[model samples]
Target: MTGAAAGTASRPLLGSAVAALALAALTALVASGSDLVSAFDARFRAGADRAFGASAGSWLGPDGPADAVGSALLGAGLLTALGVLLYRRRPGAALWVLVGLTVQFAAETALETLVGRPMPLPADGSAPDPGYSFPSGHAASATLILMVLLAVLRTGTRVWWSCLALGSALVAAVGVSRVLADAHHAADVAGGVLLGLVVGCAVAWRVGVRSPHLSGKETR
Candidate 1:
């Protein structure tokens, strides 16, 4: 590859690697019970509860409206993208999306187990969700799936920009919902977003290299 081509290819890989390193560092810090992280979590949780109150939990909790809407949106987006890729005869791109999601979920599960961080109590003093919560699965899934969709539709068009805005909004909403539901610490959501970035960038790199047509890049 020419220098420019190589650089273009390396950018996504480099981003993925950096995100991976940051995620690892955050996981280690959380696992070690860092006082700084703990303090920050406490303060953030307090502030969120004060600002949103217990009522927010009813609408943002795991079984709430936000969760339902986010799930529906993600599912529809992925299915639609898969259909389009298949129709375009870019089965490789579709396959990569499935593979990326599998990897993202597996990574989150492993990290959650490794960190063993418990959920915080809700503002209403309700029972916390039972599970290890270091990296929020909801946040990670939203980030990864929506980001992949964004990349697939990123053609520098008005539609692409609209999708970008919608995807960004959904991701933010999902992350905040998890925090408001007391299902994760603010740091947990951050770690999840970072984890998603790692997987999303890696998938994008693979798709771009392996299927330039899908990535809208000229094949060399």
Candidate 2:
């Protein structure tokens, strides 16, 4: 094969290998991160308890900035904004948005039921820490939201690289937020980010390869 053709053939393989490595890393982080788990639980609970001065004090405490920022990043409102932008720039990104939300929500509900882990808060509480901690639904959703936004941006190499940098930062921020809020352990958030990155990357990569404009652009 010609050099260009050979390189093209290797792209998917390299991508797949990288994807697999990320998955395994996440799995390990989730399965064997007890120190992080203890640290997240203690620090978050202490911070919340200190700030809130009660069981549920932190819900509307000084963490307002973090909550507001996290909500804007992780909420349906933000998702809607992202959807609108993607619809205008790259409609295929919309499909991934739907898919990512559906997968995370459905899996969280089903697994929480199966594992029967209780939330740290009440049933009707917005911060219910109950259900399975294996994967944090909030963190998953937040991380995905960030990735989808990044993916939907213009797809030149510069844009793609920029998205990668910003998206990674956003995902990490959300994960940390969950831990700081005492809503989830660090391992839980780590798992959430891992799952999100893999799922989001796959979906966004498909969109990129299939996008008429993006696919046609050559990277120097």
Query: lDDT winner among the candidates?
Result: 1
Badly placed stretches (over 4 Å) of model 2 are 1-69, 80-84, 87-89, 109-128, 146-162, 218-220
Estimate the lDDT of model 1: 0.74
Model 2, TM vs. native: 0.62
How do the residues 135-203 of candidate 1 rate in per-residue lDDT, one tens digit apiece?
Answer: 977677767766555555545767678867876777777777677656688899889899888998888
Cα lDDT, all candidates = 0.74, 0.56
- Per-model RMSD to reference: 3.3, 5.6
Best by TM-score: 1
TM-score per candidate: 0.81, 0.62
Ten residues in a row with the worst lDDT in model 1?
211-220
lDDT (C-alpha) at residue 114 in model 2: 50
What clash count does candidate 1 reach? 0
